[model samples]
Target chain A: MHSDRAPLGLKVAAGLGLAFMHLPILLIFVYAFTTEDKSYQWPPPGLTLKWFAVTWGRPDVWQALWLSVKVASISTVIALVLGTLCAAAVSRTKFFGREVISLLVILPIALPGIITGISLRSAFNLADIPFSFWTIVLGHATFCVVVVYNNAVARFRRVSGSLVEASMDLGANSFQTFRYVILPNISTALLAGGMLAFALSFDEVIVTTFTAGQQQTLPIWMLEELVRPRERPVTNVVAMVVVLVTFLPILGAYYLTRGTDTVAGQGK
Target chain B: MTSAIRFSGVSRHYGDVRAVDNVDLDIAEGEFFAMLGPSGSGKTTSLRLIAGFERPTAGEIRIFGQVAQGIPPYRRNVNTVFQDYALFPHLNVRDNVAYGLMVAGQPKAQRHGAADGALEMVALTGYGDRKPSELSGGQRQRVALARALVNEPKALLLDEPLGALDLKLREQMQEELKSLQRSLGITFIFVTHDQGEALSMADRVAVFNEGRIVQIGAPETIYFRPETPFVADFVGSSNVLPPEFVAQLTGRKAHGALRPEAVHLSEQGHSATVRSVSFLGAATRIGIRIGDVPMTMLLPKSDTFPKVGDTVTVNWAAEDLHVMDRA
Candidate 1:
């Protein structure tokens, strides 16, 4: 291996950085099993499985979880359709203001979440559209589309233009060329983008807070529960579930994109 | 003979740049034709126009006596082997070869069998299951050939197909491609920038320069009797003597080209001093200067090589001189 090994000082700093990031999540997991119900206590006096039963029994928790799942799924589907089309247009063709259009597609994610939240809230009010489940889904899809488009555009650009031309030369129509040549080249990237979009939508809080006026997504529900602690340990258990839900897809997306970097006959 | 492909006043323009200016040309059925030119000289554009990848800005193209305006490439009865091979990375060799049949909605078994046969024709019969990435560069090139041949179009357009291979492999593939074209009896329209490749493989060649066809003839004629200064210089190494020099030698005030091989280092001829000598296996290329005009001569290698600054007389037959109008 030609890669140089990090010094002991750098390794120590990396270890400290990772612990600082993940230690709080570990704390959340630990407190979920704490016997104490009123407040968090370090190295809990006792441990029990009562919070699991308590979280399972809460109807509000189930409702919020279901709502979060529904919003993320719908948002992911919308993002995939809109993002792939936008990526194909921006990356494959030249037109007036094409650079401006690409910039606008990416602006939603690059801007602060609060700015996106406020803009979406004002737009909804201007249209007189009432806040509902679809409002939350639309809010999440704004940023979700950016994630999907970023992944798709990069992959589309990497796909050789000659491949499409060769397909047509081999007697394939535009649609057939897309089906045989273009789609296979971009499928993994699209899948990774869709997964990332889902994960982002599932855990979104800022935009959902403004657009979802009366709707209670899981993150919104957790925020509400944090303000009024009926059962503190139950909230910790729900936070554990949220972490697992978001982490799995992000991990899957990473693996999916890693395998796509070595496309056949690429760079030759 | 029926003309397999014809272009009448065809021109393709990109904004202000005319990639292929108005040109008229024809290729007979079962002829191995080549379009030879430098980059951006419109040879590839002409091939693309025939393949339906580019629409002619002005004029008409016909394939097998039918007008091909406004037709898409998929509907055209021609296939192209791209310079980069352009093999589908996600597909195995068999599926890549079967792509056209798949697009036509052929049954799986029939397409697979035909694909195998195409692979056999390219001498890659048992390598169908391999991915394009798994094969070597030369093998990948064969797969690309098989992919196009499986479609069995009336004409196969090869856009510098051997450009990516090394010189040795390129020479080997050139012969194989020629044999393949002969065996298939399909009109092959090959585009290349290499003059040697075009001359060696093509039955006839069209020499292109600045979006125009300067000359079209058999390889020997194109090399020996180029119609213009551009064809004379671009087709091979030639000393284009000034009209004054031609007038002095042949009593005609005209421009003429003399092949280096025709200029022999004789004991009594025009005296010139050798500037440089380079061995080329069976022959030696000697650069000489005569009357302030630099000339090249290819002489048979002998025991005593000519040293730089050695004065020698060069001569050639009048029949070897091809005269043209001054450009």
Candidate 2:
């Protein structure tokens, strides 16, 4: 009886917090179905299924959507390789300034995104490098690596060192040990980290702003369409698409890293 | 045949701390040798050095007459069962056991058959397809054993392999391990801090103190004729009589070691006041002070012994008190 009543206030507060956070997302969903397209209206004139067809035909929308997916995919791959390597070096070895190097790795994500963007912009200009698809990918990867590094390093430390030693003792070379033992142990963490990095890169606007010269990513395209009025509901339709694209990976990342505390020799 | 492993003046010093100081040792093929000491006594370090996990700072290591220094652990012809049984959590029991063979490019069908045999040897025949986390502590230990045994290594290095089990389980594993070594006839070198474990299982024991082997001998010799006070006090907790007291009794300026069970209550002997009494299940241990030196005697449960403050006459056979040649 005490448990039932004790959590009543907690239940109400939790409900309020959920509504406060999700109300805007609900508006995006509602606007996507509204019939009025020229201006914002509190209660839509009518609801229709016209914008879904409108969104499918726009070639510019296709271009921006393709660009965003390509950038996110390339950035996530780069982050997985470099981030995993850095995590292994810092967690598995003892060297002078090791702690400081780990701290510097996370600094990109910890600092303001605008600060990273400004630094990258200046660095590109100083080097006389032209901004393009690869430049934006590089910018996204800076923060993406931090995500993968955080996840990989934590899992690496949680794993027992003796697992590697045991593999080597069983007559495995360094590469064989990594393939047969270390890789399987850290695979889940890398997958989760990669998913989160992909989601982050997909929705990033601040870094893309300083890095992209003439490119219009999906989010940037949405911004331009919102300023100069066309079919307004089509932008909401595209927003709904973006929401679906980014939300699934974050959910996937959450489930991947959950209940993964079982390390080798952890039975006792 | 040449000895399975030999260390000639091997030393591993980290800064000023000698983790494994200059050590010379040998173990014959098909022999079970144990390195025994308290923690921080360099026994485990010596095992790691033999496994090629740590390189010695000076001197040489030879395995079957081949220079072993600078060789990677993967290149060495040895396998180690780590203290906690590091079984891969991701792999099932069968795959974990087959990992060594799989890494060596063995055919899948062949390696699986070998893994089955290895598992059956450890008496875990039908436990494949279960992850390491599903197994209990004892079962995980068996899986680790099977994994190492599948490789058929020339020598097996066990670093306190039974340390994590309960008392009864530990004793059972000790017996199983001894019989397994006998049947396999492979050189087995294990490091442990338990004196009873060392004396019971090993053919020869190396007692380490402060990164150096202070005494190396058979169990009976190590227990009865410890060369230094550290070994005398460490192994079985024997009574160490001071040099001055030994000189007074034997006219020899050397230390003496007397077993607690050897001390007898007699009609005529030196009188000592009982300081403490600990009643064990099978025997009662009595602590007494003979002058300034404290000594303990183990009396059987049925024997009539004095109370905590009572004065008693204690005597022992002359051979029971072994004098150390080097004090």
Candidate 3:
């Protein structure tokens, strides 16, 4: 697809598409440094690092940040285990209703966020589970599982059945085959899945609202700060931190999976 | 010639598909055996059965006089070199070769040393530090051979191992494999669809068709005295004369197989009109019609040759014509 020259119209269209997606985030980034706290006034705000200092001092913001990190990390770990197991079962075995099982596994992510949020709230109430840090972790794991499953199943299918057979022929038992052949083949996929799950869980909003009771994650805090303004630039500053944390892993995952379409021993 | 592996009435069926049906085989130690067949003829399935990758649905497989049906592939005393060279991507060539040893609890230092020796045997020394992806197809093939041979199992099974290589590389690998088998003196059961590879390299060949063995004999016996029409036509595309033609020539009503090379132009013999003429590099192939019975003959290329529509007389030695079973 690459030619010596790209037409001017195609280049302009690509530039406009990028701007349409990232310009709002750019505005959020600029407002984090704005001196004005009451309103967002374009092209008339002075810049200062004062809101960063204020954000650093607020203990409520610190608690919310700490809680968000804890929920995202645990949810990611849980999703990694459950999702990888689910993918292996569905992709590698034959059973009755296997297709239905796979569809049900991915249903959480495909449904509206509000629907998932409401369902989780009712399920927790029916089970008599307390609405605490665990509740929010539980809510985040729903979609996190979907993210990890999507990555893992694709890699598992591509890992080559011949590789497993080769391992056995080389005198490795099932456990050793899994350890030596299957694990190494799927490690990069698992890593990418984990990163994506973490990023999704970190700034989730609607699900956190229904599930959290007397506990505020970073996104819930930002929502509250928008409704009741106190040093509004502080919220933008926190939003900037959230953006960096999620964006870095997404970038890492992209690079990790790039140019890896072909697996080893896939000779022509 | 002791028995290395034996298959007694083995059958592998999948619902309505009979992949391998009631096959009985005996392979001797220190022999290079080839299973020759078309695709889906149960040849590769039979190899996998010996490797213990696929269990026989019925009957038994014995390895060195031991029952092999209940055992898994890792516990079997045999290994396989897969067609695609399934090398571990994350590992370097050294680690890939040492995989069996590593799984058997051999120390890293000792296994790496053994891996190097195996690589040297395959003429791939000093190439261990690179990954499988870094190596070419031929190089990766050697690594796969080394990986399986390093174990020194009782038997080695190869499933269409040269199917992916180009002409020159395939020919080179074939010679290397034959000589290596001779030096190792281990039983090698090779499966392939190419008759040339089977005839040139194997001590004995088994012809499979439709999930059954159609013929089993030494390669020369198979090439010269093909017992069935399928074997005659498949092995070298020999001219298959119908039973009526045989009745006219030999007073027998059985089908006959006549090698093209045995055909020669003559002065006082059966007259035939040339239908098509093709000039190969070393030989010319002429398709002739003898009273509406079409046959092909091969001859060394010469300036004085009959062209299309030219009527010529053809003859063969009495012993060159062989009676064969119907397909």
Supply DockQ values for each candidate: 0.68, 0.75, 0.73
TM-score of each: 0.97, 0.98, 0.93
Best by lDDT: 3
Greater DockQ among 2 and 3 belongs to: 2
Under CAPRI classification, how is model 1 graded?
medium
Q: How do the residues A206-267 of candidate 3 rate in per-residue lDDT, one tens digit apiece? A: 99999999999999999999999889999999999999999999998898778788855576
Q: Which stretches of candidate 1 lie over 4 Å from their true place?
A: A1-7
iRMSD (Å), candidate 2: 1.2
Scored by TM-score, the top model is 2
lDDT of 2 by residue, B1-327 (tens): 569999999999998999988999988998899999999999999999988889999989999889996799998899999987888888899999999999988999999999999999999999988888888888888888889888999999999988989999999999999999999999999899999999999999999989899999999999998998889999999999999998888888888999999997889988999999999989999999999989999998775669999999999998898888775
Candidate 2 chain A worst ten-residue window by lDDT: A1-10
Measured with C-alpha atoms, the lDDT of residue B62 in candidate 3 is: 92
Task: Point out the higher-scoring one by DockQ: 1 or 3.
Answer: 3
Using DockQ, give the best candidate's number.
2
Q: Across residues B1-327, which tens digit of lDDT does each residue of candidate 1 receive?
A: 999999999999999998999999999999999999999999999999999888999999999999999788999999999988989998999999999999999999999999999999888989989888888889889999999989989999999999889999999999999999998999999999999999999999999988988889999999999777788888897888888888898888887899999999777789999999999999999999888778898989789877998988888988998898747
